[model samples]
Target: MSAVAHAQGHAGQGSQALAPADPLPITGGTFKPTADSLKTYQTPAWFRDAKFGIWAHWGPQAVPRSGDWYARFMYVPGHPHYAHHLKHYGHPSERGYKDILPLWKAEKFDPEALMDLYVAAGAKYFVSMGVHHDNFDLWKSRHHRWNALAMGPRRDIVGAWRDAARRRGMRFGVSEHLGASHNWFYPSHQYDQFWPKMGADYDGADPQYADLYHPKHDEPFKGNPDTWYTTDPAFHKIWFNRIRDLVDSYEPDLLYSDGGLPFGEVGRSLVAHYYNSSIAKHGGVDVVYNCKALGSGEFYPEACVQDVERGVMSGINPLPWQTDTSNGDWFFTDGDTYKTAPDVIRMLADIVSKNGNLLLNVALYPEGNLPPESQTLLSELAHWMGTNAEAIHGTRPWAVYGEGPTETTAGAFKESAAYTAQDIRFTTKGDALYAITLGEPRGRVTIAALGRNAGHERRAVQSVRLLGVAEPLQFQQTDAALVIDLPARMPTRHASAFRIAFGA
Candidate 1:
C-alpha cells in the first residue's frame, strides 16, 4: 500500500483457535449474499454530501517509524525496511514482527483531539483501521487474540475512534485489509537470504505462532497481484468472522475493503450483512460500502462506492466514488515527504468536481500523535476550508467538470501531475455554480465552459461573486467565454472559488 502508517494489535496471551468456518453472519436484512441483490445498492446522501474524510492508517508498523509493509519487508533480504529492522531490531530469524507489537504503546493517542482537528479541517467522516494487512485487529477481535485491546496499546483503537467521531456527529467507517494478509505475511515464513543465520527459519516457521503469522504457505515472491489473495477457504471464513464482528460491534456508517470484494461469495455475504445491519441501525439505507472491485478503474455505483487507492479518476463519474490517499506514506516514515496544503486543496477540489470524496490519511507515529508538519498542514487546510467549504461540501459536479489543462492520470496509485492556474474545476449546489481554480489566478481569467453558446450549460448567470469576498465580481458573459475581473488580492493562496448564481 506504500502508506505512511502500519499495523499492530498487541501481546498478552497465546493465539486463539481459528473459529470453524460458518455461514455468512448477518443474513437478516433485505439484501442477500448475491451479486444481483447488491447491484441495487444506492450510495447514501450523507456520504455523497460529506465529500471529505480523515483516516487513521496508524498502527504498530509505525513503531518502526519506517514507511509501509514493515512487518513483511523486515523479513525480506534486501528491502529498506529489512535493513532498518536488521539495524534496530535484529534479523527476522531472531526478532520478527511479533516483537515489534509491544513497542506500539499509543500513550499519546487522543482520538477526540485528532477528531477535533479533522472536523476543523472540513472532514465530515472518519475511518479507523479495523485490521491491517499484517492481520492485527484495532478492535476487540474475537477471531484471534492479537488485537489493539489484547496486545499492542491494550486499548480498543477502533472503539475509541468511533466514539470520538460519533461524539462530534461525524460519520464513522472501518477499513479491513485482512483479505491479503495470509499471503502478505508469507515472507515471515522464509529465512534470511544472506546472513549469519542464512538458512535459519524465521519465527513464522514455528507452529505456535501460526495464528499471528498465518499457517505456513509457500513463499510468495511472485510479482503478480493475484498472488496477494490466497484461495484458502478456511482463511476466507476467518476473514468473514473477524469482519462480521467488526460490523456487528461498530455498526459503522461505512465499510471499506482494501481490495475488491474479497473471496467472492463470502465478500458479497459480508456486504449484504453490512447493508442489512446498516438499515436497521440507521433506519434506512444510509450506509456505504467501498471496494476497488474493477480492474479497469471503473466505478460500480450500482454495487458499491468505487474506491481508487492513492489515485483519482480521469473525469467526472456518474456516481459517487472516493480516492483514498495520504498526506505522506501510508504509515509514518521517519523522513517522509508530505503533500503540501495547496496540493491537498487542489486534489480535494479536483476530486469533488469529479463526484468523488477524498479520504486523506494524516500519518501518525506509533505514539498516536501527528507530527508538527501534519498539524501545520491541517491548519492550512482548515483556513482554506473556512472560506471555501461552501464550494466543497453539499455540492455536486457541474454539467462539465471544468475547463482545465491539468488532468489527473487515470486509474489507481497515480497521484497525478501538479495543477496550474489554467486548471479549473466546477461544483454546483442548487442555483449556485462554483468555479474553483486549482491555483491562484492572475488579475483576470476566462472560462470557455461558461460561455453563453456552450452546448453543455445554457443557464443564464444572474450574479457572480468570489466565495470569501464580500463584493460581487465584475464579469461579462459572451458567446466565446465568461471572463471575470479579479480583485488584486485573493482570500486564500491554495484555491479561489467563484460562485455564479443562475436565475430563473
Candidate 2:
C-alpha cells in the first residue's frame, strides 16, 4: 500500500491502542531521529523570505469565548474560567468540556474568504491549528472521535485551510499543541472542593472520558508554564502516533511544535518523518519545522527555527527564527482588546530586521468567522502592507538591525519593545536598503547606521525616496548620520519606510 494509505490505516485504529514506545524507524531519508543526523537540516528560503504569516489559533476552546486554556482552567476552582463555566454552563461534573465540543458550530466558517484577507495583508503563509492543548483536534481525525469533522464544525477545517492557502499561492502550515496537552489537561481530573457540586468528580475522572481528558494522572494541573510536559511512556507513544498522522495527512510546508522537541526520541522521530516526507512529496528540502528553545542548555537550532511565543529577538539572529503571538487572547473572547495595524506593522519590521518571521494569530469566533473588529484590523493591515510591503517580504537584515534610542530586551517571551522616530529598522533587497521608522516623523529622519563614522555603511547612498510617495526625498550622508528631508504630508500613519539606494 502507499505510505499515506498505510498511515491512514494506523490512524484509523482506535485511540485506545497505542504505538510502540520506540517509534517506527526514520522514513526514507538521509536524516535519522538522532540529534547528530538531523543536524544536516537547514531553514527553507520560502519561510525566511516569507517574513510574515497568519495563524488561525482556533478550535473548540474558542467555544467558551473565554480566551486561552479555558478547558483546563474551567475545571480548576477559583479560576475565572471556572467561574464563567459555573455561571453559564453549570458544574464541570455535569457539563464538561466534552459537552462544549458539539456547541462549536462553525456554520459561518469561510476559509477562502479569510485566506484572501490574509494574502492581502501581506501574509505569505497561513497556519491552521491541527490540535490545541484542549486535547481537541480541529480536523478530520481518524484517531480521535472528538474532532471538528465529527463533532463541532462537521468540516475538515485543516484541509479547508490548506486548500485555500495553496490556491492563493501561499505556503501552508500546521501547529500541534498536543505534545503538552497530556499534562496540561490534568486539571480536568479533579473534583470541585466547594458548594453544590462538592466532592463530585469532574467528567475527566471517569474512565470513559480518559481518551480525551487523558487517564487520571498523579500529576495535578496547576497552570504552571514550565511544568506542562510529561515523562510517561504511554503518553509519549500516543503523542508520537497522533503527530505522525498529522504530518502524513497534510504534509504541511511548515510544522510547528508548541514546545521544544518533546520526549527526546519520540519527538525527534516525528520530526525526522516530517522532514523525510517533505523531501519525498516536494522533491526538495523545502519544508520548515518550528519549535521553542529548550529554555536551558543547548538546543538543536539546525533542526528547526526557534518559535518565541508572544515575543521577539533582541537583534539580528544568524539563524532564522519566528515569533508566534495572537492579536488578542489566543481564543475569541468577547470585548478583548486587540493589537492595532501600527502595532502589527511595527512588529513585522523589527522581527524581519532581526532575521525572524512573525507568525501572528488572529483569533476567530467559534463559528469560524473573524470578529468585525478583526476584519477592520485586517483591512487596516492590508492598507499598510499594500503601501510598505516591499520593505517586508523577500528582504534580509542589514549590517545592524537599526540605530535606535529604544532599549531592546533580547531573548524570548518578552513583549514587543517600544520605539521612537529614531528607532529605524534596516532591511536589504538586491540593490536597495529599506529604513523603516517605528514612529511617525515630523520634519527630518536620520539613520545613524548609514553614517560613515558609524562603520555600518559601505558605499555612498545614490538616492533616497519614501515608499508610497512620488518624488525622491533630499538626503545627506555624513560621518555622523544619513539625514533625509520629510514630505509635507506623511504617506502612512504609525510608521514609514525610506528606500535607500547606494552608488555603484
Candidate 1's error at 350, in angstroms? 0.8
Report model 1's TM-score to 2 decimal places: 0.94
Give the per-residue Cα lDDT of candidate 2 at 439.
90
Clashes found in each candidate (C-alpha, N, C closer than 3 A): 15, 0
Supply the global lDDT for candidate 1.
Answer: 0.84
Question: Which of the numbered candidates is closest to the native, going by highest lDDT?
Answer: 1
Cα deviation in Å at residue 421, candidate 2?
1.5
Query: What are the per-residue Cα lDDT tens digits for candidate 1 across 1-504?
Result: 642211121111111223236665575888887667888999989999999999999899999888888898888787898889889998788889999998899999999899999999999999998889898999988878999888879999999999999999999999988877987788889876675787999989989899989999773454433444556778878898899999888989989877667776777788888888777777778998997743211123578898888788888999899999999888998888899998899999999999999999998978999898799999999999999999999999988888777757877668867898888999999888999998999888788998888976767778889988999999988998889999998988878999998767
Note each model's CA RMSD in angstroms: 5.2, 6.3
Model 2: per-residue Cα lDDT over 63-95, one tens digit each: 889888888889989889999998999899999
